[model samples]
Structures are given as structure tokens and as C-alpha cells.
Target: MFSLPQRLAAEALGTGLLVATVVGSGIMASSLTQDTALALLGNTLPTGAILVVLITILAPISGAHFNPAVSLVFAFRRELSAQEAIMYALAQIVGGIVGTIAAHVMFALPLLDASTKIRTGGAQWFAEWVATFGLVFTILAALRFARASVPWLVGLYITAAYWFTASTSFANPAVAIARAFTNTFAGIRPADLPGFIAAQLLGALCALAFAGWLLREQSDATQPLNAEAKP
Candidate 1:
């Protein structure tokens, strides 16, 4: 088995690259296009594509759970211990912050700044819940019936969620928190984080409950998204 540190490192590195791709692509997209739709399109593609690659490459190590919500959900399902989930959550948050900083450095912007994009309201909260519900549901369902398609399924779902959701699908707590530190196109206001995160947690729980009901427990079932792990 890979050591805890090794698993943590993979989670951190994978999350960092994922956020870098998100923030960097948003910046580049905004710079290249005046139309908001076009810029969003540009931002969506690379983030989705990178998600596939990162999850596929890192699934063996840490299940590539770059989101705290995902780790928490896994813990609830007993796929991961509570301690491991907490450690993964911390690593993901730190990695997300570092990734945001890296993007700022690459773009020659300020290292850290609170976002001014005021995203709040019941509609936004509901959007977050929907987005996260879809995300966790996708992960649970795909990992059960179509293990090989998880990367594509998750990537494509997020890509679509980005456009369909009102809040642009910041379905990840760590991503939302790290993004709050940036005043970029993809950033969210820090004050708005509590509601978003609460909604995400709720959504994750709902998805887990639904998954338990939907699938009959099987001894032969794979270990969630950690199917690629090697001893």
C-alpha cells in the first residue's frame, strides 16, 4: 500500500494542477474574448479536459479527490476513514491556494486579493446544491456501474454544469475557498462562501443516500474511484 504521505502528495499535486488549469484558463479566456459566452466556453474546455487527465493519472494514488466535498462523501460511505478524509481535505485546500498563487504569478497579477464578485442569494445557493448533487451523484453512479468512464463522465458533467448552473458550478468547497482569494474571472466572494459550502455538504449527503438506495451492496464491487491504486 502507498504510504499516507504518498497519497496526500498525489492529492495535493493533482488538485494544484486542476486549480491552475481552472484559474489560468479563465484568465486567458477573459483576456482573449470580450464576449462573456466565448470566454466561458474557453474556460470550460481546458478545465474539463484536465480533470479527465488528472483523475485518470492520480486515481491510483489518492482517488484524485481534489474537492473536500468528495473526500467527505467518500468518508461517509466508509470508502475512506475520517482521518484520511480530513487530511485529504487539508491538502486539497492548501494545494488550491498554492495553485491560485501560481496562476497569479504566471499572469503577473497580485498574489492574493479577495474577490469582489458579489455572488449571493437563494438562487445561488440552490444552484450550488444542484451542481454538487450532480457531481457526487455522477461520481457515485459512474464508479459503481462504469468505472472506466468516471473521468469522462465527471469531466463532461462539470463542463455542462458550468454553463447550466447560475453560480458557474463551484461545486467544490476547497475550490470555492481558494477562488475567494483571487479577484479573477473565476473567483467568488469570500463572504458568499458559507452558503455555498453548506449547500455543497447537503448535496453530497443527499447523493450518498441516493446512491445507497440505488445500488445493491456487492462484495465484488470495486473500491469507489480508487480502482487504479496499486500495492
Candidate 2:
């Protein structure tokens, strides 16, 4: 088990890398292809792949909580200590900011301009909700039924989310915050942050509840057999 600070630091670093790769790739893809859909697919596919690989490599070390919502769910499940959860959430936020700054500097993208970024509104809000719900639910299911294969499952989930969800399934809080820093096609507005974050958090909570229910069913199904065997 890592110390609280160490785990938090790993989350921060991992989230930073995640944002940088996703956003930076989006920038490059947009420049290469003027088509919005193509650019999005080009950027997101590789980003999703990288996220799976990185999380698998880092999960045992730091739990790979690159999103605040994920950390909150873990805390709710009693899988993570409360103090560590708080620290991880804080680290994720800071890491998001840092990652955005790094992307801006490295890509020479404008940081303060609101017009250059992508944001949610109108139908986009519904999209965000759907995306987040899918993401959280998939993550929970993977943890329960496919913990040993989480990396591949997470990758496929994110990839599918990009296509199915209108907001492109930016389900990670760190990813969302980091995106706000760039004034590019991938950037999200600061004004819209609260609503999106709220939606994602709600989605996570709902997923957690669903996961609990499923676990209870599994436990109940197993208990009767165990009781019979004991007699």
C-alpha cells in the first residue's frame, strides 16, 4: 500500500499525462484533418488505448484514480480510506490544471480564450449525462466481473463511449478540467464546468448504487449454498 501522499501524487501525474495525451492528440488531429468527426475519432481512439495501458500499469501502485468521481465511488465502497480519497480528489483537480497548462505551453495553444474550446450546452448536456452514466456503469461492472481484465474492458468502454455519447464521453473529472485550459476544438468552457461535473458525479453515484445491488444479489445467491454445505 502506498502512502496517501504518494498515491495522490501518482494520480496527479497519471491524470496530467492522460489529459496531455488526449488534448494534444486532438490538436494535432484537427490540424491534420479538417473534418470534426474524423479528428475526434483520431484523437480519442489513441487516447483511450493509452488510458487503458497506463491505468493497468499504475493501478496496483496508486489505484490509478485519475478522476475525482472514481475516487469518490471507491471511498463510498469502502475500498479507499476517506483521507486518501480526499487527497486523491484534490490531487486530480490540481493535476488537471497542471496538465492543461502543460498542453497549452507545449502546443502553443491559447489558454485564456473561450471561443477555441469545446463545451456542453443544449443537447450536449444530455450527451454528457449519457456518457458519464455509461462510463461509471461500465467501470463498476468491470471491477466486479472483470477485475483481472480491467485494462482492456476500460479501453473498449471508453472507445464505445466516444461514439455513443454526444459529449464524447469525457467521463473523467481530471480530463474535463484539463480540457478547460485549452482554447482549442477540444476545450470546454469554465462557465459550463459545474453542470458537467455535477452530471458526472450523479452518474457515478447511480452506478455505485447499482453495483451495490448487484453485489448483494451475488452474495445472497452464494450464501445459501455455503450454509447448506456447512450442515
Candidate 3:
């Protein structure tokens, strides 16, 4: 029973730390290695590990929705008011940028540089959609059946999505927007933001729709009986 302001604060703090981990790790990984695969592996693990830590600590306050897509999903599900969702998104976006700046400061890079990395195409767009869809679905399903396991579930899903998805699974709109501010290995070009955000939102909505139907609890009459159950 946290207040709205408290929840918003938690969201901001959690998102900030998440982005710091992402951008910082990316900068470090690239500096350490020339191998693309190894660099990606370096970027992937910290992001996933931080998700688990942030969600575990902050979920009680703000549902640990560090992603605009995740906040939007909760709004659609009627868990959060539309205004709350919007505020949460604003906090997350702002926090993410601040985190990026912090990462840059730590590495002595420019505080706010637009990314030059070119990351846009139909394949990547579709991959963003798939990545976000999987993320939201994992959250929804885990909440329904194993509420306590949501942290690990989401962390692991994003870790795997990073490897399997062509886009490295930016899956989070706030994160995607923040990453656009950095010119590091984790960054995406500012011009590519729109497509990624659009795909993420659409994927989240689709997951909401799919999970709604799939997670509905069946009545006893609708449940299938085991073959060994005697009449």
C-alpha cells in the first residue's frame, strides 16, 4: 500500500539503476573486447542480473515496471489508472536518461550524445515485436501461476531474448529511448527509436490480449478430468 508518489519514485529509481547497468556494462564490455559475440555476452548478463535485483527490491512499491511497455500493459489490464501509467512512463524515461548520463560520467564520455549505431530494418522491427511480446507474456504468466517467481522469470526471459532476438531485445520502450542517448555499444540510433517503440507497444498489447485469454481460470465443469479419475 504505497502512495502513488512513492511508487513513482520506486519506478524512477529502479529504471535508473537498470539503465545504468545496461549502458555501463556496454561501455565496459566494448572497451575490453573486440569480439562482437563476447561483447554482447558482457552486455546481456548485467542487464538480466539487474532486472532480478531491481524487481525483487522494488516490485512491492511500483510493481517494478521499469519498462513503459510493462506499465502500459498493467493499465490495459485495469491494474493501474491511465494517469498512473503515464506518470510511471515519464518517470521511467527520465530516470533512464539520468542513468545513461551517470554511466557516461563514470566512463568520462559525453553526457548526452545521440547514438550513431545503425539499428533499423524490417527484421529488427519484427524482432522487437517478438521480444516485447515474449517479455510481457512471461510477466503475465508468471504472475498468474508463480507470483513469487516473477523476478527470476523476467530476468531469464530477457537474458535468453537477448541471444535469440536479432535486435538484442531492447523490449523496453523507456530503455530503448534512453539507449538512444548513448553512443556506446548498447546504443541504438535516435532515428530508430520510433520503430522500436511502436513494435514494443504493439507487442505488449498483443501479449495482453493473448495472456488474458490464456490465463483465465477454468471452472471445475470446464476442466478436463484425468483418465484415471473414476466416474
| Model 2 residue pairs with clashes | 118-187
Checking candidate 1 for backbone clashes, the offending pairs are none
Backbone clash total for model 3 is 0
lDDT of each: 0.92, 0.79, 0.96
TM-score of 1: 0.92
Error of model 1, residue 17, in angstroms? 1.0
lDDT of 1: 0.92
- Once fitted onto the true fold, the runs of candidate 2 whose alpha carbons sit more than 4 angstroms away are 110-118, 218-231
Estimate the TM-score of every prediction. Answer: 0.92, 0.88, 0.95
lDDT score, candidate 3: 0.96
Candidate 2 weakest ten by summed lDDT: 111-120
Candidate 1: regions farther than 4 A off: 217-231
The model with the greater TM-score, 1 or 2, is 1
Per-residue C-alpha lDDT of model 3 across residues 31-120, encoded as one tens digit per residue: 999999999999999999999999999999899999999999999989999999999999999999999999999999999999999999
Q: Assess the local accuracy of residue 19 in candidate 3 as a C-alpha lDDT between 0 and 100.
A: 95
Question: Which one is best on TM-score?
Answer: 3
Report the lDDT tens digits of candidate 2 across residue range 80-131: 8898788888898888778777767787866534534546676667677677
Which pairs, if any, clash in model 3?
none
